[model samples]
Target: MESTAKQDPTAFKRIEFLVVTKNAELLSVSKDLVEHYKFRAEYSDSVDTVDADTRLSSSPMMILISLEEIEGLQERMKNLQQLRAAFPRSHIVAMVAGDESTDDCEMLRGSGARYLVLLQEIKNSSKLYYLAALLVQGTYIPVPVSDLFPSTQVNFNAYHKLVLNQKFLPVIFSGFTFSDKKYRQLETAQQVYVRREELGEYRKYIETYHDQVGAALKKRCRVMMMSLMALYSEILLLLSLDCEAGKKDLVQSKVSEFVQGSQDLGRYLKDCPDVWNVIAKALDFQFCRYERGPYILAYAVYISLKADWGQMQDVVMTALLADLGILDLTPESFKTLQKKNEKHLKPEELERYRHHPMNSLNRVMLRELEVSNETKSSIVCTHERNDLKGFPNQSPADKIPAEAQLIHFCELLDRRVRASLEDGILTHDFVRKQVWEEEKDSLKRFNAAFLDKIEKVLVA
Candidate 1:
């Protein structure tokens, strides 16, 4: 038989946070911490609060010990071992100050600390409580704790130095949701997929122009573009190697970051024409190096024309990565690789040329970027036409994603512009008439709505 008197379960079942710090003021949870984690916290200078009390033992407990504030470091570490022995289930989070040495970080781990965090960096950090929860669940972090939390600090900004520049790479690589195994797979995948010389040449060209641009916004945008190239190049390269199976989350994470980076840059791109010009021109020249000149030209269509910011991002990424497989194919005789079936080529060669859509699809779908289904479809449907004459999987009208139609129009515009340029048609008026004619004629093949929108944006 059981006896109960109007039970209040949550009163006894609250999550407890034990913070060991000399300064109660510093230990007090910030608004971000409070709002994100609703744990009932207790502040104390000693680690004795980690005892197996009835309530704490029944619920989850996180004991955050500040190494900087505590005295007699050796004795404190000895006490930490005893405390861990006492409460075998609790997470012992060693909170060191930012200026601590790397050896100190290793020492904390050796002293039975499951988690090591810098208290100075934890004010409003999103990853703090996340690591806390993972530690409690016995998460396996593949890298050393020191790698996750690098030591020392700097403020090397022009005015007061930039805040984000210091921890940029650490924050980026560490904040992702992949496990250690998956991260290694991703790194290895990039190594195998990217052709070293081509990627190196592209990176060098971009780096040179980016340095020449000399604007902070342009430099940032260049980073995003470089990252985009690295990502797409790897995705395609991985597909060519037949090693991208079962790494969905890893691939999706990169794609998600790429999209996020593109969207983030859209904010700076809104009213800054000079900044946009620098970035677009750099992308154009870089793509020209690899014979995918249409790649960036398609992207420039979005900036040169008026379109929705969201739609602009969709088209920009679609245009950038649609022909990713072309990186592997050295198109020496590759005049007009855009068309589904080139009349000048033999049947088998044309078939091989047409295989790029499949290669593009294979690379993109398996690697799984957190892009829209429409975006993925746009990539595969790169060769599709409104006349119902596309190859592989001739997606009829209305079957294609909206962005595919947008990309189709842009691809056509870029191809025609290139044709005019290569033909030595130097007059600006001739090229403008050429673009305007193509845009007007493309209403049937590409969607009419995008044509109408970009037609207004087309300047001679």
Candidate 2:
């Protein structure tokens, strides 16, 4: 159980604690409890000896009276009865030693201690503090098993179902229930469902909640992303493990899971066009760059908006599929092509590369996807340059579509970032500076406002 201290910022603000125990050991336990939970606590040697008139006057949140003290001064029980009568809002808990008998337990329950905890049962005082906090908040915390038998299995499901769902005003008012293993289990289950690869299953789960689908989806997204991040961590661990004969199979399985999971999430985004826009925007700001394909698409969107360049969806999608033509190329050949000098390329070889944008665009268009004509046109012209320096038709600034211009900038940015990551370059700022120095004149032909916006966003 997590100490409610750090998690609940407001837990100690309103609750005043009273610890009434004569035993030096139990009194020390009470002091530790107060220190751990960061709560204000007052201790009295005996409940009967306590200044009831002064203690009751403060209207403390709760009073903790030891059962031994109560038994020693039975007449003080009358005083407690009167205090309860005078301050109906105050709560009292009876603390008992482990050696107390069953009859004593029943008597304390009958004596008006709303809750009872045994000293021996508490391994540490934080548990007592948590219990007291729950009581003060008016939550029905089940008697700890330790109070009965040390190391008993806690029925978390029943606890959440019964205690958390209770209609008590304080339970509702507190805004959070006690943190326990059961609470963690529910959180884990919700996260798994939220981040599951099957969109159909995820949507079905959301539908089950009916009226709260929107809120549920929002909550699920956080859980799902956190799960995905955790999965990525596992993948990293798998990659780092010492290789054995069977390790290759295990590592490949992990890779397959990661790829499939990402594809499933992408397909889900495809189903909701509006949601895709939001996802696209967020992906733009994410720092991870190991996945160049998705990052490139995100960068395209960012540039298109920054440039006020409409009709970019197809261009972005085309960029996504642009490398397909070279997929069949061997790893060595791919590296060679990436390193090839554009200035020395033969006319035919340059022409092949020039037509790649159109080739990719047509491939996607033929798939019967619901894309606009402007988007397709943007894809066809992405290679066109601003100073009439680019391929195919050597198109000038006026001839190139605004969307294509945005795509070109993003493509360059993607290339630079990837190269930097691969080569151990330290800063995005340095990369941007290099790009500006090399392409400054060409960039001038583009819309000034567009470049300004992009610069502001990148710097931010």
Clashes of each: 3, 0
The deviation in Å at residue 215 for candidate 1 is 6.2
Q: Give residue 377's error in model 2 in angstroms.
A: 1.6
Local accuracy of candidate 2 as per-residue lDDT tens digits, 1-460:
1122224454332235666667676776666656644555566665455544334344445677766555443554564565466445556766655555556545554556555555543432133443443334322222211111112232222222222212122211112333455344444323111111222232333334323234334333322333333344334323321111124566556545544444444333333333322332222211232224444555555445444455444544444445433322222333335454344456655556566566556544443334467666666667776666665567666767766766677667767766775677546667766665456545644544446656654543
- Candidate 2 error regions (>4 Å): 1-291, 312-318, 321-351, 365-370, 441-450
Q: Give RMSD (Å) of candidate 2 vs. truth.
A: 23.9
- The positional error of residue 238 in candidate 2, measured at the CA in angstroms, is 30
lDDT tens digits, residues 104-217, model 1?
556766777766655443543323543443332212111112111122121110011112221111222212343565445335323111122233333333344333323644
Q: Give candidate 2's whole-model lDDT.
A: 0.46
TM-score against truth, every candidate: 0.44, 0.37
List pairs with backbone clashes in candidate 1. 157-161, 157-162, 252-368
